[model samples]
Target: MLTNRQLQILQVIVDDFVTSAQPVGSRQISKKDWITFSPATIRNEMADLEELGFLEKTHTSSGRVPSEKGYRFYVDHLLQPQIIQADEANQIQSVFKQQMIEMEQLIRESANILSELTTYTTILLGPDVQQHKVKKFQIVPLTEQSAVAIIVTDNGHVENRLLTLPNGFSPSDIEKMVNILNDRLTGVPLQELHLKLEVEALEILKQHVKTADTVIQSLLNVSTGQKEGKIYYGGKTNMLNQPEFHDLNKIRMLMDLMDKESQLQSLFKPKDKGIQIRIGSENNHMAMENCSVITAPFSVGEEQYGAIAIIGPTRMDYKRVVTLLDMMRNGLSRALTKP
Candidate 1:
């Protein structure tokens, strides 16, 4: 229930602090062309805002800084839309101009461009590649004792493994096994191949092939070796350049956390669509307490998808980042899904 004047003052403080990475003082607020208030009046309001827990004064300076609460309120209530400049928009569009580019390449370029624009580390979580159905599976025999197993997904991705053929496993046995697998698992997603093979497929294989257990074990080993939609990072080392991340211990902790690929996969799991902002302690990771993350989803058709995430110091320019991300998402969706 802030009065209009108080709200105006709060917005100004947030905007100034974000740009300068410095606290805002009454004199600076009074200097705004639209602000007719005297420095004394502005100072009084700043004090009251501090008392209300929206701002805090530094011990070394009388200037005020926005608390986490203040930043939350500013983004939620006072965010003014920022327009993307024409040149910047053109630059993003140009990344996809080359014909016959891939979704992975598009995501990789997006991460690099976003990181460069924001001067912060960026992460793009590619869609689960394992979700695609198995289009083909083949075993290319190299000799009587060994062969190469290849699994092709509907998306055109391929996985290949080599195994020693079981003793006395015949060429006829190989033909029958391949036939059984293709017939039963052609439409199954790569992630579920193991389970599909184990269920009814195993029994069918036992009845027809003498070395069914050995072959199944070899294929399951291949399935376990598969990795999907690995995390792609842009300017992964840029965090070291930020003033907030200058501490040696803090750098070590963040590096350690980012190295845990399994844990980071869940970071971009958003229940809702559109841009989401998580600031400082809101991220719940101790290493991220001084950072802010902005995330958004991009889709191919109405189905396949992935997420874009930008990480930077909490003082990052929210308006500009949000505008760029929205444009990137729209541009990528249009470009990657075409032919």
Candidate 2:
């Protein structure tokens, strides 16, 4: 446990290093408006804090920098939300309020805007449509031999496919099939639709629809698509602009990791519905040992969620990034899911 004064000094050191990416000296810390103590007194406290494993010196005779432990402590205890100005908030809001024809384009733009705003690498993890629960299903008849299968998830995400009805299947047969699917599978997850169709819904289809097995197979194929999800990235080159990433080897590590979308998918681990912060080595990935990962999750509807991940040097402006992601997730949920 830290005393009030010690916590204050640590907070100042963290905030200063996060901005400047430099070792903090007592003289430098003393210049802050809140530090009324003399440089000598603050130096004594710094030594004590170092002994307690919170700070480390980069060189034998250099000033102090926060160790991974120190950063973890600072993130867990000393961080606060840095409120963005109204003008800045409005600028971000403007992007979402504009109705774009495609959610994918809106997400792409959002990633770019966040990276520009924070000067950090940002990733938007799009929810897997394969996992979204069914909200409604429609069978639009184009002709006696053809129709379209439209499935809407509870989150408002939609997937559709052109389906050809087998010969001898009538309009009445199509209605019966749609009713049976909606009755048995309205709340079923997309990933499980195939099994549900085969086990229960298909049995009902076999009884009422002619060439029932064939038509049922077509509906199942359309309902359970194989569309793989993607990760939207902003500022893939932005981290090169950060001082902490000056090492070419470190830059290569990040580049390689980002190149693998499957690895990027495994990088995010949100504990609950709240924002998650992983400082330096805490992320448990070697490539991320010198980086910090911050995430905020938002829901579109039942079991459908996506997140904003900001990747930066360990000396990240935690206060600002956290607040920005919080605003972004909420705004995105509203924009995409609202009627």
Candidate 3:
């Protein structure tokens, strides 16, 4: 455990490094407003910190910078949660009040606002549908052998799929199948629908004709396949301005990762509560080794919906980022619950 004075010096070093993007020296800390120690004493403490693996020296002459372990320790122990300033809170509330729209639009706008506020790339994943109940389904015939099926969930999410009818199946036959699907599938969660199909409907369809087996398989695939939730990304160019991404190779890898929606979705897998911080090397993606991700999950009613995340270099201001994300989550929750 570090002494109280040593902790103060470490905090000053981190704060200075974050602001200036430069390693902090003992002489600099001694001259700062908060320090009363002499330069030699501070240098001794910095050397001890380096030996303990909390700080690292990038060059022979340069001072110290916080390591990943240091950052994790600071966030978990030393950092205090900052309250959102009055003006910032009012601005966020104003945005939520002015643009009351559908859930999809709201989530997209929230991503835009968060990126603008934090000046870092932001990603918002639309709500997970595992718990969603199918409220309605509509089948529209596009051609004699093809039709469009639109499924609406209880949470205002709409999923559409195009299905090919069996050869020689009439439009009337398609309508009959649609009616049966709606009657049997409405108000049921998606996982249960697959079971119902295999147990009760598959035999009946098979008895109709041997071709019914293929039709049943196609229907089940359309219903239970990937949901393809919407992903909203903003502030792509903002990453270029960060110091850690000055390397072209790092920038290229990061851009590629950003383009992969599946990877971003995996990064923010749901947690219980509060914002989650993933630091360098802890992130599974090689491209994010120098980056940090702060994410918070938001919900609609009782269901955990989706997450909003801020992406920045590992030296990101956690206190400010955490406060901003907390406010964003609250605003999103309230907007979603609004009548």
Say which prediction, candidate 1 or candidate 3, comes out ahead on lDDT: 1
User: In candidate 1, where is summed lDDT lowest over 10 consecutive residues?
Assistant: 221-230
Q: Candidate 1, after superposition: displacement of residue 263 in Å?
A: 2.0
lDDT of each: 0.83, 0.83, 0.79
Candidate 2: the clashing residue pairs are none
TM-score of each: 0.79, 0.77, 0.76
Q: Which ten residues in a row have the lowest lDDT in candidate 3?
A: 205-214
Question: How many collisions per candidate?
Answer: 0, 0, 0
Better of 2 and 3 by TM-score: 2
The regions of model 1 sitting more than 4 angstroms off are 135-186, 192-222, 225-228, 336-339
Score candidate 2 by lDDT: 0.83
State the TM-score for model 3. 0.76
**Residue-by-residue lDDT tens digits, candidate 2, 1-339:** 888877877888888888888889999988988899999988988888899899987775457888888889998888889989898798789888785435666677889988988999999888877777887888898887888888877755677777877877787887888888899999898888888989998877787775778666776775445444558999999999998889999999999999988777778746679999998888898899999999987765555677789999999999999988888888888887775
In model 3, pairs of residues that clash are none
